[model samples]
Target: MVTSSSLVYLIGLPLFGAVFLLLMGRKADKWGHLFATAMSAGSFVLGLLHFFAMTNRSEEERPITQTLFTWIEAGDFKVDAALLLDQLSICFVLLISGVGTLIHIYSISYMSHDENRRRFFAYLNLFVASMLLLVLGNSYLNLYVGWEGVGLASYLLIGFWNQKPAYATASKKAFVMNRVGDMGLTIAIMIAFATMGTVSFDGVKEAVDRVGTPTLTAMGIMLLVAAAGKSAQFPLQAWLGDAMAGPTPVSALIHAATMVTAGVYLIVRSNFVFDAAPTAQLLVVIVGAITLIFGAIIGMAKDDIKKALAASTMSQIGYMIVAAGLGPAGYAFAIMHLLTHGFFKAGMFLGAGSVMHGMNDEVNMRKYGGLRKMMPITFATFGLGYLAIIGVPPFAGFYSKDEIIATAFNSGGAQGIILGSVTLLGAVITAFYMTRVMVLTFSGKPRWDDGVHPHESPALMWLPMALLAIGSVTAGYLFTQGEALVHWLSPLFAKKGEYDELMPHSVVTVLAITAVIIGVTAALMKYQFKSVDSVVPTDVSLATRLARNDLGQDVVNEALFMRPGQALTEGIVAIDERVVDGAVRGIGAMTVGSGATLRRTQSGYVRSYAALILLGALVLLAGIWVVTQ
Candidate 1:
C-alpha cells in the first residue's frame, strides 16, 4: 500500500535537516551533510519502490494516492494535504530524487572545502524535498506550496555565494521574476475555486469539464502565464540567463532537472483543460516558438560557458512547451524530451562546472583554451552532452526532439510547419554555439594569464558528469522500446481520446537521421572548417550586432522595467518618510497642543480639584429638581 508516511517523509525529512543545521550551526557541518544526503537518498529509494509496486498492480490500483489530512475547509469547500503516486508522478520522483542524490554526493566533494558546507547541503536537501512535493501533490494548493518552496530554494542557492554582490542580485532577480509569473497562477487557482467549488485536482478537472470552453480558455491562459514564468519563457527569461551566477551543480538541478521543468509538468498535469481551449494551446505554441528562436539567437553571442548553457536551456524548454501544446502526442514528446534534457543538460552544466573548478572559477571562454589534453574525461563527457543536445544521430535528443517537431508540423497546420522550420534552424544554431563553446574553451592556444596552470577536476566532480553523459546517450533509446514514448505515457493524458497513430516507423527514422546529419554538418562548417576565429568579421551588420547584444532585451528590461521599479521604490520610501510620517507627526503635535491648553485649567492644588467636583455635583442636583417640577 502507498503510505501517508512516505508523503510525510518527502517533506519532513529535509525540513528536519534544515532545522537541525540551524540549531547545530557550524559545528554540525559534517553531520548535516550526512543527514541531508541520507534523507535525499532515502526519499529516492521510496519513490523507486512506489514506482515498481505500481507497475505490478492492476489498473484499479495504478494510481496510489495518499491523503494526510485536510489542509483547508470552509462551507462546501475543502482541499486535502495529499500526495499522488502514478506513472506520471513516479517519473518526476525518479528525476528529482535520483538526480538529487547524485547532486548531493557531488556536493559533498565539490563543497567540502567551503566554510558553509552545512548550510549549502541544507538548502540543497530542502530544494529536492520541495520539488518532490510539487510533483507529488494531489491538488494545486499543495503543488503551489512546493512551487514556492523550490523558488525559495532557488533564491538561496543562486545567492549561495552571497559574498559576491552580483550573485545576490541574480538570486533576487530569479525570485522576483518567478513571483510575477506566480501572480497569474494564483489568479487561475482562484478562478478554479470560484467556478469549480474546490482546488483539488479531481474537483478542478470535473468543474472545468462542466464549465465548458470560456472557463477553460481563461484557465489555460492564466496557467500559460504561470508556466512562462516557471519555465523561463520569452518575456521573463532574463533571470534564467543570469542564473549562471549560481554554482554549476545548482544550474544543473534548477535549470536542467527540477525547477524549470515544473512548467512542462504543470501543463501536462492539466492536459484536459488545454484540450478544451484551442486558443490557449495556440498561445503556448506562439510563446514557445518566439522563445526558441530568441534563445538560440542570443546563445550564439554568449562567451561565458555557463551563460551559453543557460540560453540553450531556455531554448530547449521552448521546444518542450511547443510539444506540450500538441495534445497527447505532443505532451508525451515533451515529457520524453524532459527526460533526455535532464540527462544531457545536467551533464553539460556539471561538466562546465568542473571546468570552472579546475580553472579557479574562470568562466569566460576568451580567457581559456588548450585544456582538452589535461581534462580529457571532462572534454569527452561534455562532448557527448553536446552531441545529445544538438540531436546528433543515436543520441538522446534525437528521438524526443524529432517527435515533437514532426507532431507540431502535422498538428499546427501551416503555422505549425513554420514553427517546425524555425525549430529545425534552432537545432543548427544549437550545434554552432555548442561547437563554439568547445572550440573556444578547449581547442585554441592557452589563453590563461602567466603563472596559471589549468587541470582536470577532482574525481567527485567528473563522476556525475560521466553518469549523465551515459544517460544523454542512452535515454532516448527507451522511446524505441515497445510502441515508442507516446505509447508509454498514454494513461496520463486523458484527453488524447481516439486518435490516429503517429507516422509510420520508417518515415520517422528517415526524418530523424536526416535532421541529425544536417545539425552535425552545420556545426562542422561553422566551428571545425569555417573556423569561428577567422570567420567573424570586424564590422558586424546591424542584425548580427543585435544578436551579439542578446537582441538588446536586457537593455530594454533595465530601462523600462528594472530601473523604473527601483526609482518607484525609492519614491515610495521618500513619501513614507516625508509625507506620511510628517502627517502623523502633525497629528501627534496637535494632540499635545490641545493637552497643554487643558493642563492650564489643572492647577496643582487640592482646592482646584474640589471646585470642579462641587460644580459637577450642583449641576446634577439642579437637573434632578427641574425634572421633578
Candidate 2:
C-alpha cells in the first residue's frame, strides 16, 4: 500500500541527500557523487520493489493509498498530503527513478569540472523528489506542489551557468512562461473545488462528470493551457529550444522523462474532464498536431545539435497530446510513448552531450563530421536512438508512435484524419532531421577548426547512453510482445480496452519499412558521401515556411503576450514616474512650502511668540463661551 509514509521516503530521501550535501560541504565532492548516485539508484530499486509487490497483491489490494496527514482543513474542506499507488503511478515511478539514476551517474563525469557540483546534485535530487510528489499525489493540491517544484528546479538547472546572462534569461523565460500555465491550472482547480467541493481526483472526476458542458469546456481549456506551458507546446514551447543554455544532462531530463511529461500527466490524470469536453479534446488534437509538424520542420532547419533535439522533443510531445485526445485507450498509448520517448530522447541528448564534450564543447553539427571514427560508442548508441525515434521496426518508438497515429485515424473524424496525416508528415520530417544530425555530426569529414581535439566520453557518461540506447532498441518489444510490461500495465488500460484490432502485424511492418526507406533514402541522396563543397538542402519546397517558424505561433504569442507585457510594463513605469510618483513628490513639495510659510511667521523675538500664544488662547476661549451660550 502506498501510505503517506511510502511517499515520504520517495521525496524525503532526496531532500535528506540534499541536506547531507550541505553539511558535508567541500568534503562531499568525491563522496557526493557516490552518495547522490547511490541515493538515486536506491530510490529506483525501492520503487521497483514496491511496483512488483503491488503487482503480486490482489486486485482489491492494488490501489493502495497512504495519507500521511491533513494539509488544509477548512469548513467541509480538507486536503491531505497523500500518496497514491496504482498501476499508472508505478509506471511513472519506474521511469523517473530509473532514468534519474542514469542521468545522475552521467552528471558525475559531465559536470565534475563545474564549480557548483554540490548545488547541481542538490537541485537534481530535489527535482526528483518533487516529480515523485507530482506523480504520486492523490490530490490536485499535492500535484501543484510538485508542479511548482519542478518549475523551480527547471529554472535553477537551466540557469546553472549563472555567470552567463543568456542562461539566466533562459531560466527566467522558462519560469515565467510556466507561471502563465500554472495560473490557468490554479483557476481550474479553484473552479473544480467550488463546483465539486473537493480537489481530490475522485471528487473532481465525479464533479466533472456531472458538470455542464460549458464548465467542462472552460476547465479543459485552462487545463490545456497549463499542459501547453509545462510540456513546451506551441507558443510556450519557444522557451525550450533556448533552454539549451543548461548542461546537457539537464536537457535530457527536462526534455525526456520529467518536466515536459508533467503536462501529459495532468491531462491523463484529468482524462474524465477531457472526455466530457469534446471541444477541449479537439483543441488538444489541433495543438498537438500543429506543434508536431511545426517542430519537425524547424528541427530540420536547425543546425545546433541540442536545438534540433529540442525541436524534435516538441514535435514528439505533440503526438502524445494527440493521443490523449483520442480517448482513454489512446491516452494509455500516450503514456507508453512518453515512457519510450524518455528512454531514447534522453539517450540522444546525452549522446549529444558526449559529442559536445569530445569536440571541445562544439555543438554546431556543421563543425562535426566523421565523428563515428573518434567516438564509436556515442555514434552507435545515438544511432540506435535515432532509429527507435523514427519508428523503425522492432524499436521502442515505433510501437508507441504508431499506436498514437493509428488511434488518431480511428477515433477522430476528417479533422482527426488531417491531424494524423500531418503527424505522419512530421514523422517523415523527424526521420530526415535525425538522420541529418547523425550523418552530419558523426559521418563525412571533421569540419572543426584547427586545434580541436576529439575523443570518447568517460565510462560514467557513456554507460548511461548505453543503457538508454539498449532501452530504445528493446523497450518497444516490451509493449508489443513483452509479458512483464503489458501484464503490469493491464490494470491501467484494461477497463478502457485494447488496440488489438489496430495492431495488424502486416500493417506495422509496412509502416516500418516505409519509414526506413524514406529516411535512409533522403539521408543518402541529400547528405551521405555528398561533397562537403556542395551541400544540398533537404527541403522539398520553400512553401512550407509556416512550419519553419514554428507555424508563426511565437509571433502570435508575441502579439498576444509579449507585446502586451511590454506595453503594460512601460505604462506602469510611465504612470509611476510621471503620474503617481510625480503626485507624491508634488505633495511633498507643497508640504515643504507650507512649512516654509509657517516658519516665516515665527519671529526670533520672544515677545512675538508670546503675543501669538496669547491671541490663540483668547480665540479658543471666546469660541468655547459662544458655543455654550
Candidate 3:
C-alpha cells in the first residue's frame, strides 16, 4: 500500500468548512453556503485526482493508507487513527464527495429562503466529512468514530427546523433507533478483539480463517444489525420515512446518497467475515429480502412524495444488502448498484424537492398533477431517475439490479430460488410505486388548490438534478462495460465469486423487463385512468391501510418493541423507585429519627450540664463510701 498525506485533504476540506462556518456563525452567513460548496467541490476534485492516479497503479499499489496517529494504545491492543483509499473505498469517496458537491449546489438555492441557511450548509459539510471518514477509515474502530459522527450530523441535519415538534420528534426517533443499531457495531468490534485479537479490516481478514465459525457468525450478525439500522432495513427502517421532516435537500444528500448507503458499505467492506460464516451470510440475505418487500409495500401507499421516495430508498438498499449478503459473488455488483443508486436516488429526491419548491413547499402528491410543462427540467430529470430505478433498458438500475437478481438466482438450491423470486417481486412493486409517483405528480391534470402557482425551480436547484439525471441514464452501462467495475474491484475479495448461470442472462433480462411491464401497466391502469381523491380515504382495505402505515412497522415496533421497551423502562424505573430508592429513603428516615431523639438530649443550658455533673459526683462519692464500709 502507498502511504500519502494527501488523503487527509479529501476529508479535511469539508471538515474545515463545517468547523469554520459553525464557529464564525452569523459573520459568515453571507458566504457560508458558497464556502461550503467550494469545500465539497474541492474534495470531489481531490477524489477525481486520486481516482485517476489509482488507475495508473498496479493492483498492489492502488490502496493508499494515511496514518495520522495512534487512536488507542493499551496492553496488547492498539488502533491507529488512519484512512485507507483503496479501489472499494475510492468508489465511496467519489460517490460521497461527487454527489455531495452537487447536493451542496442544489441546497444553495433550495435553502435560500430559510434564515438558518448558513447553519444548514454547515450541517451538510459536516455530513459529507463524516461520511468521507466512514468510507476512508482503516479499521473498524476508526470507522466507529466516523459512524458516530455521521449519526450526530444526521440528527442535526434532520432536525434543522426544530421549531416544529414533529420534525424534532422525527430526528429524535432516527437518533434513538440508530443508537440501538450502533450498539451492535460496538459489540461486533469487541468480539473481533476478544476472538480475533484485532479490529482492523486487514487484521480481521487475515484472522478469519483462525476464528471459529460461530464467532465469525456472531460478528457478522452484529455487523448486519448495524447495517440494517444505518441502511433503514427491516425493524430499524421505520425512522427513514419520518426523516423527510427535514429539508428536501437533506433527503437527497444524506438519506438517499451518503449516510443511508453507509450500511451497504459496511457489509461489503466486511465481506471476508461474512464469507467465512455461511449462517450469518444467510441471515443477511433474509433481512434484505424481507426489507425489500417491506419497503416497497409502504411505497405503494404513501401520498407524500418524499416519503414515497424514502420507501423506495429503503427497498433499493435492500437489493444492495441482499447482494452484499450473497458473499463474494455479489459483492462487486452490490457496490455497482450502490454507485448507480447514489445518482438516481439522489436525483429523484432532488426532483421531489424541486416539485415541492415549485408548488409552494407542498409535499402531497395527491395535490400534484400535470407539472411536466411547468417544470420541464424537473420532469425530465426526475423521469430519467424513474426509468433508471425501474430497470428500464440502458438506464442505471437495469445493469446493476439485474446483476444482483441474476447472482441471487445462481446461488443454487432453495436459497437461490427464494432470493430470486423475492427480488422479482421487489422489482414489480418498485415499478408500480415509482410509476405511481410520476403519474400522480407530473402526468395527470393539475390538482392545484387556491393561491398555488406551479413553476420551475431556479437553475441553481435544477442544475444538480439535471447532472444526476445524466448519471442515472449512463452510470449502469458504464459500470458493466467489459465488466469494468467488477474487474476493478475483484482483487480485494478473497475469492473470485463468478458462478455458472442457473438461468441464462437473456432469460433473466426478459423476465425483469416483463415484470416491469406488468408493474407499469398495473400502476397506469389503477392510478392514471382514475381520478385521485385529493384527500386520503379513511375507510380503505386493511392491506392499503397497513401499507400506508409502513406495513405496520411502527405498530409492530410499538406493540412488540416500543411498547414492550417502554413498559420495560417503566418497570425498571418502578423497581428502582421501590427497591433502590426506597432503601435509600428508608435509611434517610432512620437517620432523621435517630437525630430527632438525640436532639432532646442537647437541651441547651449550661445549668443542665452543671447539674448533671454534680449528680455524677454525688453518685461517685456514695459508691466509694459503700465500698469502704
lDDT of 3: 0.93
Give lDDT tens digits, candidate 1, residues 518-609.
75666566555643442345587787788777788789989999899999999999999989998999899999999999999989999989
| Candidate 2: residue 159 Cα off by (Å) | 0.4
What are the per-residue Cα lDDT tens digits for candidate 3 across 559-605?
99889888999999999999999999999999999999999978999
Error of 1 at 400 (Å): 0.7
TM-scores for all candidates: the values are 0.88, 0.90, 0.94
Each model's lDDT: 0.82, 0.83, 0.93
Runs in model 3 deviating more than 4 A are 591-629
Instruction: Please give the ranking of all candidate structures by lDDT, highest first, separated by commas.
Output: 3, 2, 1
Runs in model 2 lying further than 4 Å from the true structure: 1-4, 482-505, 508-512, 533-556, 591-629
For model 2, residues 556-625, the per-residue Cα lDDT tens digits are 8789888999999999999999899999999999999999999988879999999989999999999999
Clash pairs for candidate 2: 3-66, 4-66, 370-443, 396-476
On a 0 to 1 TM-score scale, where does candidate 1 land against the true structure? 0.88
| Candidate 3, pairs of clashing residues | none
Q: On TM-score, who's better, 2 or 3? A: 3
